[model samples]
Target: MADEIKNTENQELDWDSPISKDAGEFEIPPIGEYTFTVANLEKTMSKSGNKMADLTISLDVNGQAYVRHDYLVLTSNMAWKLASFFECIGLKEKGQELTHMPWDKVPGARGRCKIIHEDYNGRPTVRIDRYLPLTGSAPAQATAATAPANDMPFEV
Candidate 1:
């Protein structure tokens, strides 16, 4: 069906045309920090039934573009991760508190994140290790380079 395939040109494909198999496998980027922009966000439920925000982020590594998905599961266990993400996206300052999350403001927001390679289901994959403060917009209390290792990125 025309709607089934995600063709870049948006044209209907010829059913009998030979398909190209030259598409190569994805190459995982090196582990490190990279600048990322929020491509999309969907509020959903995680596998364990916790409320979550699924974030699609576009990463730029030395001029090459990569994409990765990260989830913010709203649970006490994942609070630190959520805080870091909010801080990285400029939603809140380090140690600041918030009564509500403005989810609409997340799309198009830019930030920094650390990426890592790991095995998931026996297949190699890349994942966002953690979020970092955006460059040039460090929190008033501490710069990115000086922020403590355990610093929380959201309001308590």
Candidate 2:
């Protein structure tokens, strides 16, 4: 009986079977400017115990779906990025002081952002170049900011 049970178990496992035979590779979108909406935002701690805000922005390219995430470290110098992002969506103006705004109010903000295709650890990854203001007419593609050379000391 034990031998029969072991045979049944072996038959249930198919080492040669594929989980998804029809699965195809996902194509990365070309680098360019695209309209994006702040789909979600969350506050978390960085590896060094620093407070950071993660923003998940959604991109719709010719009906194709894509997502770009950005992190804002809550430091005096790094705070400008967060302010610039708010300004891009018309929430704040240039040189305007940021008030006590709740992080939960970040979602639903719409703006234009530049997307760049980059190689991360030999893998293709999409990154947000920069955020542009939402004007009556689409503004020119903003310049891509230089990313840090080293990997961030935290995981999403």
Candidate 3:
């Protein structure tokens, strides 16, 4: 048997009460890098009918908390994006090919990534530009080490 759900259509809302103007406002974050934590993960289908994982991530910018959604569409051409998601959540190391993704471990995982603002449907919106290595993670350290020597004779 399924649990009964209460119907609230007839319930009246307190419209006369004062509400904060910024309570439900969504602000487009500035284009830059930010550390984010996975708040939720839900399996869904994209508009194109492809299997997709919807991720709700929480991030702080300038001491303000914000939530953003990222979609990981399952497809052959989208494998790279999926891999990046795994790497960002610490499920797999960067450059490590994975055949399976452990979705259960994603929630509460923290990672870093770049965010960019772009025009979508004739409106300005922000989105995840690319996943990045955590600041103190091994991949970040390796990248720093592999950087070209600043004293090189020519620009790299």
Among these predicted structures, which one has the highest TM-score?
1
Worst 10 residues of 1 by lDDT: 1-10
Best by lDDT: 1
lDDT of 1 by residue, 10-101 (tens): 44678898877696556677899888878789999999999999988878777766777888999989988988898898887788896688
lDDT of 3 at 50: 98
- Model 2 lDDT tens row, 29-141: 78998887677788998787889887877786776556667888888877777777877776777776878545765787678888887777677777787887667743333
**Candidate 2 overall lDDT versus native:** 0.69
lDDT of each: 0.76, 0.69, 0.72
- Regions of model 2 farther than 4 Å from truth: 1-23, 137-156
Q: Output the better candidate (1/3) by lDDT.
A: 1
Q: Which structure is stronger by TM-score: 2 or 3?
A: 3
lDDT per residue for candidate 3 within 1-156, as digits (tens), equals 011111222545596966554633345668998887777889999999999999887766766656788899999999888888778767787777776889877877888889988777676677888888544553221121355557776777
> Which TM-score value belongs to model 1?
0.74
Ranked by lDDT from best down, the candidates are 1, 3, 2
Q: Give the clashing pairs for model 1.
A: 96-155, 97-155
For model 3, the stretches where C-alpha displacement exceeds 4 angstroms are 1-16, 19-25, 138-156
Superposed Cα deviation of residue 83, candidate 1 (Å): 0.8
Q: Please report how far candidate 2 places residue 15 from its true position, in Å.
A: 20
Q: Is candidate 1 or candidate 2 better by lDDT?
A: 1
